[model samples]
Target: MTQDWNNIPTSHQIPHTRFLVDYFIKLPTQVTAFFLTHWHYDHYRGLGPNFQQGLIYCSPITARLLERITLVDPQWIVAKHNNEPFLVEHVQVTFLDANHCPGSVMILFQTPEGSNYLHTGDMRYTPDLKEEWKILNNICLDAVYLDTTYCHRRYRFPCQEKTIQRIVDIIQNSIGRDSHSNEIHCTSRHTLYLIATYGIGKERIMDALIQKGYRIYASPDKWKVLQCLEYWDSCLLNDSFTTEPCASPIWLVGWNRVAENVPGRLLPNFEALEDMLYMANYYRNKVNSSQHGLLQRVVACIPTGWTWQGNNREYLQEKDHSRLSVYGIPYSEHSNYEELYHFIAWLRPKQVIPTVSFSSSKRQPKHPFDHLLAGTQVKRAFLQKWLNNNPKESCEDDDKQSTQQLHNQPKIARKGDILSYFKASPFNS
Candidate 1:
């Protein structure tokens, strides 16, 4: 089970390029409860008095992180950390780290009917669970809602750990290119204007930089989420001595208005970027072009996406989308094509469902049981062709039942189900 994306509020309802998508929205069901995999504005967006009667569930890291971001009172927050399962109003909700975000969780719902449902909320394939978290023990999973955004074959799929390391290397090289990486900004005000993306790849970038000796940037709101990381407290943070009152950017001047309406008025610590004015050429040329001036000026970035290929190219071609000098270095926090396919095959879920951002609709997979989204077209097509050659259902007989029917087909082949991204390994943080 990935996310209960159940609503697309009218455009002016809130802020963001896409409609808000929340898995844990309030609802009146017999299950009577919900859990948010992460504290993204989308997941937590539109939460209101509707939730007063019901309870919220999540890991401790998620609870505290959300509390720090908003002043909604910590007491109302219900927490069940990783490795611990939670029971909400008779519904057993277990927390499995999605690996997409630190506190992001996969929910297992065991209902009164004895049927079991699993929802993986925005999880990437880096799903390393505790030794005790054996899904085989479930015996049978009635249904599964997969992150089918990348279920197709066209995506560039690769090992997540390798991608993460590549991103770290890129940042280390970029920042350490200059000798005084630790040097504070002087002359003009600068805060590494790394644009703080909502969720997705933000945590990995922060973790990587901190490891490489870059101090964590902590505005009060950012400090809250960063504190949840294991080493955040012990980790070094940039020193600040500014007397200016700390204010939320969203509250004072909407981030969209920051560039146009107010620029230099922000405090010096907030503007702690470096060398862009003097070393602008080096940064631009890093990507083999002077394009992406805006992205280069941004210390870091996070772009939310369902399909890795769609979003990946979207960022890479941001120059075409906008005037911002933005270049996309492939980084994603969701599972790639190969991982999703392998996971589905491993779990062997009876029925696969797709999570969508819509309300007033019957709970159903966006696509049929055949998970054929654009991202995994290659894998799906190959599988279709292989199955066509060796029909599993019709060819089976009493003798074949004693053994395996799949003789000619490679249980797994590199070229067979591989996607475009799998060929080149775009760094997924």
Candidate 2:
């Protein structure tokens, strides 16, 4: 999770740009424009119905959510299309689908000074992003303000599809019946499925479940949020809990209502389990006894990237009580370690500024992902190749000046000091 250090000016502001991405709290007076990457609460912490800041730029779907959920003034929101280049304060800006959620985007800023920067609010590194980069003619990025939520080496998990499939299999196996079978087996025990999710995102899981002919029950608030998504119509969602338990066996709950991760162990919320049991019993009594079986089983699945701890198992299942079984599956929307490494290597940006970390001060010295940066020699080679291919007036003189400045600077023994070298080189311009 990215720490919200509202006091850190550099953490929110893009270098040489007046725009701010995903920084709403404690709004800075110098900000020329505000950009929202998605509708997630963390990204729009300080935004509310009374938000009167400068125009907020985002995708159309996100714009709708901001108006419907946050109740922000529609006049203040500017909906930009993906891959469309527009000018903000004479700086060319474009939005690329982030592949993280419904309307998430990676903002690209290209200045007239020939400098480029990418601010990835939060992204799941996929082939689609690589294809998007190719469409931009593969311009060399000067810096990338990255979403380092899962930058650590321990965060390698299966892709979203595989994880969702595993979750489906777990639910199917727990129900003790084939999902494709048409015949219904009458038993004394009833199974209740619970999925934990945030306000937005993770709708893919619900969609997958609905595709398999399962009815989902969601809170009114959650349903309203889902209605803003493009795939809302396809979901078989019921907002009222007055229906029979078996009618919509799958229920969507808050993230913490399912399970909480402690330092050394995972603890299931027994109160939630009791509430599920109570609901099951109440529904069973309200209807004919022969119409439905007793609700005897409760299965809770918590999908998150943080649950993976270098284990080969698809999910960690624990039965704290005979009636309840909680499974923590590795389903994350953020880029994992391998994804982050490959992305940075592919871009080979001159400087990498991590956007997510425990502390802003920890970003400078002994950064956890410092090793992911391209080495000085690798950057130099890439720069030489780029300059040779895209020859421009004064290119040679600029290269020579940068090299002379590097040579004139004091000797530094750090081997892979790309940031330090770039700071001293004229290429920084």
Candidate 3:
């Protein structure tokens, strides 16, 4: 069931919300099963309370990330790949791709009564796909729970390819060889400090940095997440550049808590006006000039810019933009507005669900479960599992199967139904 959105602030006064999964939602009936589409604190488990037992389907990456990033117990996690089906006796749970992060999955719950339901956790567009996004556009559905994270157009974002390269080029030119030379040395010896963000989503940025030969360092908490990457061997194995001892790492903390204690040491960047001022005048000036005592290296890459939202605008970009060879690489783990909208529109769910609000100016009653389930491969897995489980009932299952291949499900809305099904159920309300 739904709860008041305002309680979110007081709910978890921490830098990020301790109400990780946000508030709990209860169905009028017994909560037989649960699902975690992705491991973002906002969507998955939280400080809310105990999880109702059953099957909590998610992706392998989500499992690793959950164990590493959240308090979600390993026993509770059922890591399923895109379209992999894990049954809870009567409820058939299929883990599909949400495309939110490395291991996000959407949920497809088929009731024993033959009611088919879809929950698109949080999804986005990725260039590499076998079927132009699962090829599931034609499935007719009773209804679908959606990811309205970016339902309105205002929250749209750019494609990762364009965005990633732009950020990399800026970093390469700034941190790598500039017009002068191709050396990776900083102009100033000042620590190339950064305010780390999107522990899961932004891992790629750090990986990219390490790939380009920059020393990789993260806070101990962040390292918890880093340690869980199964494919990380390709990037970190014997690769001396991927890590630096951060026994006492500086924090890239939230801008709101600039004055608060940062455990070891917190360095504020462009999270706020004052932080930007300090960086612009103090840190930015260092990167601008190449003189710093016997240490000719000036401390560059001190974050003149902050997180993605900080760089999403002109003032933040221009004012807090990197001045020194230390570049301000604007990047994010979340799919941008365009990808969010296109993915949602393409999925065309019968119903859209509201998710955690992005910001103050950008709140919506509808959540984004659709975008979270875009590239999920769990359909195939579910089918296989179902077929194996109910061999005798193959004819019955086939009878219900729609002519539409899962990928080609048309998402057009039936008139007037939006208002009826669009609202959260009374029990949730």
The sequence of per-residue lDDT tens digits that candidate 3 reaches over residues 1-429 is 534433333211111111122223432233334556676666654422254444455678777776656656677776776665656655666666665666776566666676555655565555454263463556544444545443433333445555556545544553432355322444333233344355565555555565665555454565567567665656546442323332111223332423222211224333343443354345434545543222222122222112223236521232233331233333434444445445545554444444523333322233333322333224544666787873333433432342223224333232212212134422131
> What TM-score does candidate 2 get on C-alpha atoms?
0.79
lDDT of each: 0.44, 0.70, 0.44
> Who is ahead in TM-score, 2 or 3?
2
Stretches of candidate 3 off by over 4 Å are 1-29, 47-55, 68-73, 126-135, 177-184, 188-195, 240-332, 335-337, 357-429
Best by TM-score: 2
Taking all chains together, each candidate's TM-score versus the true structure is 0.58, 0.79, 0.59
Lowest lDDT sum, 10 consecutive residues, model 1, at 243-252
Model 2: residues with Cα > 4 Å off, grouped in runs: 1-7, 176-188, 236-246, 261-265, 287-290, 314-321, 359-375, 378-429
By TM-score, the candidates rank as: 2, 3, 1
Lowest summed lDDT across 10 adjacent residues in model 2 is found at: 418-427
lDDT-sorted candidate list, best first: 2, 3, 1
Question: Each model's RMSD to truth, in Å?
Answer: 12.5, 8.2, 12.3
Off by over 4 Å in 1: 1-26, 29-31, 48-51, 127-132, 136-138, 177-196, 199-201, 236-325, 357-429
- Model 3 vs truth, CA RMSD: 12.3
